[model samples]
Structures are given as structure tokens and as C-alpha cells.
Target: MTKVVLTVDDSRTMRDMLRLALAEASFEVVQAVDGVHGLEVLSQTEPDVIITDINMPNMDGFGFIEAVRRDERRRGTPILVLTTESDAAKKQRARAAGATGWIVKPFDPAKLVDAVRRVAA
Candidate 1:
């Protein structure tokens, strides 16, 4: 089955890049503008994996991950934090909030696809 991935980011360019990369890899892509929008998207679709940016308006990735974790149906879903922040503290914080993995921004397309495949359920 083709995996569906939900990507949440405030940057339109980033969202477009991700959509292109994942779609080229044969994965179905869904997008949201920010964390709040991400939750709204999640309500409408069950994605195999979720990739989110750390910094966003309205709600950040940590808050997004926490919110997802709070929902029993989504608690076990794998979430990958894709951000420009490479800080160890931020990574730890994301892990605490229930993210399955981390990918630094300006990510390589192949590696990003690999990460998604590795974590997808």
C-alpha cells in the first residue's frame, strides 16, 4: 500500500518541497499550515506518518506532538520532527513530547524518504 504522510509546516516552500519529494517517492502526501491546522488535518485522515516543523505560528511542533499523544487513536502514530533547529535540547524535548525521530531542515530527499520508511507503520 502507498503510505500517506501528513506534513505540517508554516513555510509554503518547505511544504511544496516535501510534497514533491514524498510524492515522487510514491507516498501520498497531505499538508497543513501549522500545528493547529495539522490537528485539523489529522481529524480528517489517518496518515501512516507525520512530519512537522519545530517553529510554526499558532502552535509549535512540541505542542503538536503533545496534542497528538493526548489522542488515544493517534498516540501510537510515528511522528518525525523536521526542523532547522539542531539543538540537542530541542530534540530531547520533541522526544519527550512523543516524536519518533528527528530530521534537520534542508534535509536530503533520499534520507527523508528513508526516515519515513523506517518509521512508518
Candidate 2:
């Protein structure tokens, strides 16, 4: 099966950047505007992995991961948080919320691809 990836962020440019990078690595990208919408997408799309931004309207990354972990079908899905904040506390919160890994933004295209490949596999 073709591996699918969910990219959740409020910014269209960030989603585009992720699409370009992950597509080069042979994964299909599905974009979502926020955590609430991300969950809706997950129901229909069933991505192999999820990459989400922490601060978003409607719902944030922490809420998204919590919801994902609560659902048995999505409990094991790999969730990688890509964000601008580098605060240790935020990272700890994400780790506690069940995030598989993290990538700090101003996203390095190379690191983004490598991180996705590493976690999604």
C-alpha cells in the first residue's frame, strides 16, 4: 500500500513545503487546517503518520494527539510535531501527550524529510 502522511497546520505555505519535501521521499501528503479538521481527515484518509503544528486555531497539536491516543484505531499512529517553539516545557507536554517525535520549525526541508521517513517507517 502507498504510505499516506497527514500534514496539519494553519499555514498553507507550511503545508506546501511539507508536501514538496515528503513527496520527494515518496509519501503522499494530505493537508489539514487544524487539529479538529485533522481528526476528521484521519477518519476518511487513514494516514501512516501525522505531522502537526502545536499552535493552531480550533484545536492544537496537544489536543489532537490526546484524541488520537484515545481512539483505538488511531492509537498506534506515528505523530510527529513540527513547530516553531523550542521551549523544553512544550516538548515535554507533547511527549506526555503521546507525540512520537518532534521537529522544530522554520522547517529544514532535509530534516523534515528525514524525520518523517524515520518515524513513519
For each candidate, the alpha-carbon lDDT, in order, equals 0.96, 0.91
Model 1: lDDT equals 0.96
Candidate 2 residue 62 Cα shift, in angstroms, is 0.7
Q: Please state the error at residue 63 of candidate 1 in Å.
A: 0.5
**lDDT (Cα, tens digit) per residue for candidate 2, span 1-121:** 6689999999998999899998988888899999999999988998989999999999999999999899998888999999999999999999999999989889888888888778777
Query: Which regions of candidate 1 are displaced past 4 Å?
Result: none
Q: For each candidate, give its TM-score against the true structure.
A: 0.98, 0.96
TM-score of candidate 2 to 2 decimals: 0.96
Best by lDDT: 1
Checking candidate 1 for backbone clashes, the offending pairs are none
Q: What would the per-residue lDDT of candidate 1 be over residues 12-118, giving only the tens digit for each residue?
A: 99999999999999999999999999999999999999999999999999999999999999988999999999999999999999999999989999999999999
